[model samples]
Target: MEDALWAQLQNTGLEEHDDKDRIEAESDDEEVDVQEELSVPHEERLQGPQTGPKGVKADHEYHQQKKLVTESKARAEYNARLLAKAPMTTTYLQDEANKDREELLILQAEEEEEDDLKYYREKRLRELKNMSRQQRVFGTLTTITADEYADEIDEEMGDIPVLVHLFDESIPTCKLLDEHLRGLSNKYSLAKFIRVSALQLEFDLVESPAILVYKNGILIANLVRIIDEVSTRFDIDEIEDVLTRHGALSENDLYDLPTNYA
Candidate 1:
């Protein structure tokens, strides 16, 4: 009986031992599954390309990433090229605009300068022409003496027709009448206007300045040298009476005189 009991105990212990071994074996199997999941991807990378549509999709994804990277690089290069050209374009445009403005200003200034030069040239020409005309006219005068007109002076101015003489004080002939003709001009109303000079002919004489009338062709009277306030020397009415008696101072003999002394 003891031997049997000992054998039964041994059998029970063996069953428990077998259960522990089975449990240990199952734990080892789970550990081996986890290890295989972790290590398998490395094995597959070494094994090279996969199979079916899954392999194709993975390849497509890789190519898509490559295509995106290439497109990004090309865009960056194009942007850099545009940036480099921008400053040159702006500078060229600015320079061209400045040149156009400068040219326009220069053209306007030249036009104004040309106009001023033309005006000055024309004004100088006019002045020169006027000077030439005056010189030509003044060149034609002739000299005269008092003795040549002595008979005409006495006959016309002495007794019958009272005359008022207008002569240049500087001339020797005019100086001869200094003692004879004094204060006679203020007494005459219908008087002769005379100019006697060798240089200028502003009034009537072809050669001047000389004794002449204010009107160019009307010979109403001639300027002669007579001394004294002659109307008072002989009362103007008495002189008129004398003049009328001698066929002078007639109504038809009178003419218009120049009022402008200048």
Candidate 2:
């Protein structure tokens, strides 16, 4: 009986020792598997959690959506900054346009002022020249002797019409003619008038108050015994008509006279 009991105890001890060795071997194998898993790269480790193709596709889609959301947020921030500066940019452009328009208006005004000044300056110059020309022309009748006839009537005539009256101072008709001629000289300033003694030219007293007209140093008309050729008692109008008919005087000649004279 004692040997049987001892044999049973020895068998139980051996079985316990074999069980401990088997447990130790299984624990060492699990430790080697964990070390190999840790030694793999990080990418393989990340893929290790995926069960199949569906999980891998789902993960790829998740990362793609995340990237799209990040890009959308960056675009929204850029648009927000641009919108904030829009008002200032529009205002700056409008101000530049207004400044350019004002400068153009100022330039146009200056050009108009310059044109007005030029117009008035030219008008004043024309008026001055007309005044100077009037001052140089003869405005009244002048007396001349027989010796001065060539110098007074011919040499100084130029393109002007010259009227010479050969008169006897003693005759009443001749004296009347001189008064009319003096008035005519002041009225028709463009024409030259002069008188000389009839006796100086050895003319008869019966043919006294003879009239002669000259133009450009050429004798154009001669009237002897003028009181008989025209009306017996003629006024200034009849004499002026006779001179105008003979081409010695013209209506156009009155334009050179002053406006107040007429």
Q: Pick the candidate with the highest TM-score.
A: 2
TM-scores, all candidates, are 0.23, 0.46
Residue range 74-183, candidate 1, lDDT tens digits: 99999999999987666778999989999999999999999999898777666645644443211111233444333333433322233323355555545443322222
Error of 2 at 184 (Å): 1.5
What is the C-alpha local distance difference test score of each model?
0.46, 0.76
Model 2, span 36-59: residue lDDT tens:
766767556444343333477757
RMSD of each: 19.2, 13.7
**What TM-score should be assigned to candidate 2?**
0.46
Clashing residue pairs found in predicted model 1? 180-227, 181-226, 181-227, 182-227, 182-228, 195-210, 197-209
lDDT of 1 at 251: 53
